[model samples]
Target: MTQYHFISGLPRAGSTLLSALLRQNPAVRAGIVSPVGSLVAAVLKDMGPDNETSLFLDEAQRAALLRGLFDSYYGALPPGTAVFDTNRGWTGRLDLLARLFPDCRVICCVRPVPWIIDSVERLIRRNVFEVSKIFGSDVGGTAYSRAELMMAPSGLIGFPLNAMKQAMHGDHSARLLLLPYDTLAEHPQETLAAVYEFCGLPPFKHDVDDIAFDAGEFDARLGTPGLHAVRPQARREVRETILPPDLWARWEGASVWRDPAFHRRVAVGGTPGADHGTAAG
Candidate 1:
């Protein structure tokens, strides 16, 4: 009986690293972001009340159809294994997700806003020879300008933060578990321990230092090689600041997790919701 779960949150916030480590568990299947969530959304809208086909199905039928779609998508995996669906949009659709799978848990991987912005900028600068397929060839501007474009209210990297914030305040927040990027990079055992427990799974050994993931296909298409590369050990990148001093200062005080209310207290088998593994609702 395969169970469903979600992995999402801020971009460059270690979700990729987390996924790599998660796949270490033989009973767990996780990978790069999947299109299932988007497909679910499309199916729902198309079968919504306005659609003629919707009238043929009642509440139970609709529910069964949606659930079946997931089963069919992940049907190739071995039985009795838990499925983790990765997508930044999951944080934005907590309510819908909860209603769809009452027992499902959402694991959000997050990091400081300033650092998240800095990471993307660093990637852009490193790949000077190759135009980033993510930002497109016309990333035409200074490092600071590019940062602004990526952090603005409607920026590509900015939307996930806002969406996660909204879910934190939403009614279904109890199903969410927040994993700070630093924690996973610095202390993976404890981080993954809490995740497994929250999702109602028994303990399984995870070789944090023996992790590996090859994102060659998507990375090449995105024009951002090594985007999902993970080192064997969990360690933070140590290097000089690529962004200018003034530019760095722009996002100096953007660590939302620093707030007393957002403090993470995830221990083994930690409960979900605002005060525990989840963000305040």
Candidate 2:
């Protein structure tokens, strides 16, 4: 069977950056954000609306449907080439993925908790999503508006962290790789080597283009003066509201879905110090 790899993490948790870095390697062929398998199954569910019950389906039925979708989506990859799929939905389902594709490799991308929350706030101000709330959230998931619904834990990148923990404990634990967001930003080559080794791919040796932080790109704003700023710990406060009620609901409820590590940790497999990797020089 062909090998497949997934790069999963909370939104704004360096997923895109890692994907870009991985694509720079000659041994890999990453795909665009075409969530082929999951999207197809979801569309299938919508076809016969009356028979579709999102919450009522049993685990077996859901799994079967998902497996079919996976087959349809992944069966098309060109032979012998490894495909890196950077989708958040696969975070919790890594184990299931192993069952579906025994040769699959999973990478769990992590950052500090505070950084993720701050990123969400910035996205809200930029009108990325019409809502500020995330479902199953501790602070933002209160009874309010549309932004809540869209940002609801269920909607805001619904990859369950609990599922990730369970997968980590399962038989496929060796196949799963955890990556730090900060390290990838500061030393991408070292991080990329670990990923390549675990996936059974050839070593990577290339300098990637670095995009420095640009405030003007997102039209960022600072924190609120005194009131609504302190408690939520807003990083980029907004002058005017940007989130819609439904979207806010989803964003708010989506808090638990977040990985607690928003920043780099000390003893996470690799050394904390900046140990450089020579890219085949």
Candidate 3:
């Protein structure tokens, strides 16, 4: 089995920054999001029980094939480097993934739902000249309207948030860790400590003050240029939200996942990440 993990959580919640920082470890190989998860899901469906080819394949062969796909994708990497694949799609496939890799874990990088919305909204406004790649460049509306669209049941922001909530309530919840945005943005040392503890690897000293990552080619194609870029110095919060007061109020009560009590009830890591531990419910 390959040494691999996943970095998936809410959009605009620091997954890119986290990946950039962690890869500073010479033993770790991580970067922007990968399409491996999507490809695997598609292949598995085609090879499922209904497929005519299924008759020729046994469970062992299927497992080997799946593992082969992963190893093949990362074949160019050095033999001993650990891999961390970033994708929101992983959240929806936690059960399937657990069956495939018993020891591997899915790290969910999360933030407050409202703040998550705000961050995405700010991005939308910043790229006013170009449409976002999230909604297929077809998205157009006022800030509130776009926010509403983003929070739609199937949207980029909404779906992952919902999926993560389900994972929290699932039996494999302990296999998932809710790494808060504040923890990564503010106290990266402690945050990475917890990650190393979970992954059973010794901690690597990350240059938090001089961190640098830029997925320029990918972001340019994504129509959201600078989407995954990180500055040299780390900062606590993104710029202030651009949404009006009323629209912002609507999301204030949506961050139930931020509560310590909720973490105690759901997250494997029972500590609420930030010192500000307040819950809507």
Candidate 4:
């Protein structure tokens, strides 16, 4: 049987890089975000009580159908391959995942909220000629306004952050492995070892110096080229904030995951004393 796992959490937080590193393992198959998570949600909606056809669908049927989605979508992979599906939505659907694949684990890539906004703004500036879909139809706005939109409850960065928070506090929190972008970039080999241990997978040497991954076409569609690109080297680049002083101050201490209490609840990369929880990252 094929073992399945997940890569989720905030945007621009090294998920693409993590996937790239993981892909180096011959037994593992991972990539940029996939459609399976959304497809699973669609399937559930159709089978839900709101649908007239749902009256005929029993629990067993629903379970089987949901399981089949993974089977079908990844059918092309060689049997026994470990599949790590990347999707920010998965963190919010842990209950469904627990039911469908109890052995599955979710790795949540995270960064300070301020930096997340800063990163998005940097991308917007880089693609000066292109108005990103990230801001929706109202792309004409100041950095402050764009930051507000991105921090709205349903906004790109906001939603994933909320979902990850919920997962961290939920019953299935142990199934999550929190991988901070800085930790992953600064100490990739050690980070990968923790990830392997969390997923119950045997260790495989990964090349951190020459990693490669990109989703240029996918990013272009969103008008944000290079959103999913990974650098050839996995190392942290220290830089000053591009955000204005006031903006930087506003979100400076917003990294709740850095709190000692939060660390006590979920496993954090490079933190040996962390809980280590009971499941995947």
Residue-level error in angstroms, candidate 4, position 127: 0.8
Per-residue lDDT tens digits for candidate 1, residues 129-233, read 777766656757777778777776667667777777788777877777877777777678888888988899988888887888999889878877777878889
> Candidate 2, overall lDDT?
0.52
True lDDT of residue 108, candidate 1: 83
What does the lDDT come to for candidate 1? Answer: 0.76
Error of 2 at 34 (Å): 2.9
CA shift of 8, model 2, Å: 1.3
Model 3: per-residue Cα lDDT at residue 71: 90
lDDT of 2 by residue, 1-281 (tens): 55678876555556666665565654566633446546744754654446756556666676677666655676766667677876666756666677667778877766433334445554544453343223333333422342334334564433444445556567677766766555666666677777777778888675555422222322222221111111211022223223343433333433332333522222234632222221111
Once fitted onto the true fold, the runs of candidate 4 whose alpha carbons sit more than 4 angstroms away are 263-267, 270-281
Against the true structure, candidate 3 reaches a TM-score of: 0.89
Q: Which ten residues in a row have the lowest lDDT in candidate 1?
A: 272-281
Ranking by lDDT: 4, 1, 3, 2
RMSD (Å) of each candidate, 1 decimal: 5.1, 11.3, 3.2, 5.0
Local distance difference test scores for all models? 0.76, 0.52, 0.75, 0.85
Comparing 1 with 2 on TM-score, the higher-scoring candidate is 1
Question: In angstroms, how far off is 179's CA in candidate 3?
Answer: 1.0
Q: Write the per-residue lDDT of candidate 3 for residues 1-281, one digit (tens) a residue.
A: 35878887788777888888888898887877787887888789988877998889888887778777789899888876788888887878888778777877878887767677666766677887887877678766677777787788898778888888787778777778887777777778777878888887777888889887878888878888777878786667535556576876887765657665554233334445352223322
Worst 10 residues of 3 by lDDT: 272-281
* Model 2 CA deviation exceeding 4 Å by range: 40-78, 126-159, 210-281
Query: Which of the numbered candidates is closest to the native, going by highest TM-score?
Result: 4
